[model samples]
Target: MKGLFKSKPRTPVDMVRQTRDLLIYADRSPDSRESKREEKMAELCKNIRELKSILYGNSESEPVSEACAQLTQEFFRENTLRLLITCLPKLNLEARKDATQVVANLQRQQVHSRLIASDYLEANLDLMDILIAGYENTDMALHYGAMLRECIRHQTVARHVLESEHMKKFYDYIQLPNFDIAADAAATFKELLTRHKSTVAEFLSKNYDWFFAEYNSKLLESTNYITRRQAIKV
Candidate 1:
């Protein structure tokens, strides 16, 4: 038959083209095809993970370095915003924790390179909505506090947090009647202000009157604690 001699089934490139067309069709279909969309998103996430592995892997050869950089740029170009939103709801607590660690590692490794992923994640409105959806949970708050510290390191991130509705939850967590949470929040706040003195001082100058009374009261209380300890020692 003629089919039996058909150039070894049109070669590998033909197969790849067919597969790509199928994916394109599925991705553009209606919401009724949600399962297909989810599968596509999962595949995207897998590719991102592989790219991250290459970027942060143990190999230090120039080829590996170049490949890593290329992969990161490609991944960022393709899925920077989508990855942040998709990963938020699907990530388990461990994955969430790892995500924070990855952001920290990226900051340390790149220094002046600009945080493409974190900047995209922080700015994506969909991701912000998801982030704030769990704002009231204690565990989420803890993770958020850590992320906020990292965000405060960058001016753009600091501005995003300051303008977000999420700021209310953070302020509430710090002012809670629970002494333990409040204490933890105070420690975190002190660290944030120490690290980001100029930006935070500017923020305080504009907004201090809104919170100055409570902050001053807390400062006085802390002073009183130190004074009482000294008196007891005397």
Candidate 2:
């Protein structure tokens, strides 16, 4: 019947849930060449684009809807972050960028009364380390780097990143042989040091002995122009 074929409108929650399911399947069987799988991925991409539009808004002077933001925040509170992280390294370039953009946009929203907060980010502190590890994969580094920068926007996340022993790994990441990955690592380094001024200052003062000594030799005086530039900016 025509009635049976009519399209049902999807709410924001429905779209997010669908995205999460697709990400899980994509991550588990990324190399599958089946037509159904490919079609599902294309549909997933379309859903993400639509979700981006809803959270942002159209071209008119119409005020952005607070309802969309609230719905998105609720979605973040679910297991969606796990799906996003697991799927980031599996997606193609375009979908990966869109996925990272979704996380970045969510970081800019607030759920509990305030207009800007980090409830979603603060809950997932371990993601920073996982993202840092993403630098090991050349194909996924840029997308993960973009997501890392957004995570570091939260003071709590920034502090965790600075204090974790993982901070020592940047010395090698910024010097990676691949230009793009190294450049992205350098940008992530700069964001970590500069985003929360007071936190970084405290971290530096506390770890003054070895931190600067390594920084001076590897980053500041390095032959790579981008490394030196990023050091100066940091």
Candidate 3:
């Protein structure tokens, strides 16, 4: 019975210790198995709430340590890329949210930039799907949308979403009743289009009426101006 209770386990401390030990081990190992290191980090990622609690409980002055660069490289390897994609759906919302921050930290590591870029781009697709699904719940939509937009901006992932049929439908759906929601969606869409001219052209060519009806007339005129400018350049 005492063993069963076991003081409920100090999981947060254990997790921090394990993560630090993994980093140290990976650093000292000559010809370390990077895949194993990444596996350990991925396991650590599963306890995101515990990790966050621990991190926040500590002095606010102490910054979160970056994950090892080799582990990030291992994660970007094609085989591990598939594993990450598969694991993303299993992560809870808090874990998924923390992942963005982790990726940002990894990106700042000089040796890990390329690997972080590749892994982050792949991971972003799954995150975007999660964001879109959350949009179905009105209470969560705007919050999730803002997070999604930030992710898209950081990763340049909005191109994929802007080109997706599902996202187009979502944009249209948001435009139906709430002017504020519609305006927000339009602003996001406009930013996406600005980044991906060809995608916007294709979308506008196919769905001109919907855009014109839902967006303000001034925005429509501006879009037309851009389209005409591009046509002339062509």
Per-candidate TM-score against the hidden true structure:
0.54, 0.87, 0.44
Cα-lDDT of candidate 1:
0.48
Per-candidate clash tally:
0, 0, 0
lDDT string, candidate 1, 1-234, tens digits: 998777763222332233334334434544646786667645544433443454466455322544544434443444433444334434456545655554444433331365555555455545444444444555565555455465456665655555555544544555555555555555455554556567777777877775565444544333556422322222
Q: Is candidate 2 or candidate 3 better by TM-score?
A: 2
Task: Please tell me which model should have the higher lDDT, number 1 or number 3.
Answer: 3
Model 3 accuracy (lDDT, Cα)? 0.50
TM-score of 2: 0.87
lDDT of every predicted structure (CA atoms): 0.48, 0.79, 0.50
**In model 2, what lDDT does residue 109 have?**
72
Off by over 4 Å in 3: 1-46, 49-58, 68-111, 115-120, 123-127, 154-156, 176-187, 194-210, 213-234
The residue-by-residue lDDT of candidate 3 on 1-234, one tens digit each, is 777766656543355455445444434453657787567556646544445443333455453334244444433443333333234334446655664444344334444335355346655576567566655655555545555555555434765676566555553544435555544555555566665667667777987886566444333333545433322322
**Best model number under lDDT:** 2
Error of 1 at 3 (Å): 27
Worst 10 residues of 2 by lDDT: 111-120
Report the lDDT tens digits of candidate 2 across residue range 1-234: 889998989777788888888877877775777898888788777877766677666586442566676557656757787677877665667777777877777777765555343666677777787888989988888888888888888899999999998888988898898988988888888888888899999999999999999999999999988778767876
